[model samples]
Target chain A: AQSVAQPEDQVNVAEGNPLTVKCTYSVSGNPYLFWYVQYPNRGLQFLLKYITGDNLVKGSYGFEAEFNKSQTSFHLKKPSALVSDSALYFCAVTSGAGSYQLTFGKGTKLSVIP
Target chain B: DTAVSQTPKYLVTQMGNDKSIKCEQNLGHDTMYWYKQDSKKFLKIMFSYNNKELIINETVPNRFSPKSPDKAHLNLHINSLELGDSAVYFCASSQTTGGSQPQHFGDGTRLSIL
Candidate 1:
């Protein structure tokens, strides 16, 4: 079975400061990781994904994630945070060999202070 | 235009009542999915259909059934709705069932049990 863990329930960062949301995964085969953001009363919007090739993957809204194969972790990062970036972030993972089912973490609430 | 859309954005009903949430995707994708987001912001996949065929079904109760009339539409029907069924349901679509293709999502339908 594949699973994802987001250790932090909430993360706070000041505006214009860098922010990171940690994510770790456990999967049998290769991991296909993804990050999504959800605003209030809205569905999750795809941020980025890490499949193969480069470890650093860039995504929408100036967000990026690094896939560390040695550590089995894929953490989302942003160079500079904005107040509008405050929302719920989710990390999901799926195995390359299994059915198309994504296992998601509980979610991390990001609060960007101005 | 909206790529993915769901009807009945907000649903409020008493226990034991039956309700249905409809979803449609205009992205010309072959795969569609239904997900439930609980109060704690935990997301879990309920069902997925590829080319109008059932592909993935989680451990959801029999009371919840999903039907795909065509490639673009996937509707969810719940019988004997309970308090535990109250959550935000999201519809999503992807180009295919496998690989690193990112899935697009609809706004979501918030269900409330009275």
Candidate 2:
């Protein structure tokens, strides 16, 4: 079984400041990590993913994430925070083989205060 | 065009009623999934289908059934709905079941059981 953890229930950041939403995962084998964002009354949008090779993966809307195997973490980051970027962020993990389900973490609500 | 879409964005019914939520993906993905976001905002997997075959059936109750008539479409049917079933049901699809293929999601159907 695969599982993910997002420790913070809510993250507050100032506009123009860098923001980070931390995530950690546990799986039997190499894990496939992902970050998704959900806007108000909207569906989840894929942000970034860490499959192989590059530890730092860039995704849509100027967002990026770093995959740290030693730490078992995949934290989403942005150089400049925008108020529009405030939303519910979720981290997910799935094993490389056998299982097809993606275990998602309890979402972290991001609030970019102006 | 919408990559993934689900119908009846809002569903309201009474206890012991039966309802269904329909989902369609135009991204030509091979795998589709059903998820539930409860009042606490925890996303949990309900079921998964790959190429019209049931693949991942989580610990969801038998009252919940999933049907994938085709690769592009997967639907969820709920029988004898309970107040606990009131939540947002989201449908998603991915290009493949393995790797870091990001799953695209729909706006979700908010089921309010009164």
Candidate 3:
């Protein structure tokens, strides 16, 4: 079975400061990781994904994630945070070989303070 | 033009009532999925259909049934709705099951049981 763990229930960062949301995964085969953001009362919006190739993957709205194969982790990062970036962030993983079902984390609530 | 859309944005009903949530996608994708988001912001996949055929069913209760009329539509029907069934239901579509294809999501239908 594949699973994802987002250790932090909430992450706080000041405006214009860098922010990171940690995520780790456990899967049998190669992992296909993804990040998604959800605003209040809105559906999840895809941010980025890490399949193969480069470890650093850039995504929408100036967000990026680094896939650390050695650590089995994929953390979402933003160079500078904005107040509008406050939302719920979810990290998901799926097996590349079988069972394309996405397993999502508990979600990290990001609060960007101005 | 919404890529993915769900009807009945807010549903409020009493226990034992039956309700249905409808979803449609115009992205010309071959795969569609239904997900449930709990109050704690935990997401779990309920069902997935590829080319109008059932592909993934994630141990959901028999009270919840999903029907795909065509490639563009997938509807969920719940019988004997209970208080525990209240949650935000999301509809998503992807170009395909595997690979790097990102899933597009609808705004979601918030179900409230009283």
Off by over 4 Å in 2: none
Per-residue accuracy of model 2 over A1-114 as CA lDDT, tens digit each:
678989999999999999999999999889988899999899999998888899999999999999999999999999999999999999999887555688899999999999
Evaluate candidate 2 and give its CAPRI docking class based on DockQ: medium
Chain A TM-score relative to the true structure, per candidate:
0.98, 0.97, 0.98
- Position B98, candidate 3: lDDT: 79
Winner on DockQ (1 vs 2): 2
Please give the C-alpha DockQ score of model 3. 0.71
lDDT of 3 by residue, A43-82 (tens): 9999999999999999999999999999999999999999
lDDT of each: 0.95, 0.93, 0.95
Off by over 4 Å in 3: none
lDDT of candidate 2 over B29-110, digit per residue (tens): 9999999999988999898999999988989999999999999999999999999999999999989887568899999999
Error of 1 at A78 (Å): 0.9
Q: Which digits, one per residue and each the tens of the lDDT, describe model 3 over residues B60-106?
A: 98999999999899999999999999999999999988746788999
TM-scores, all candidates, are 0.98, 0.97, 0.98
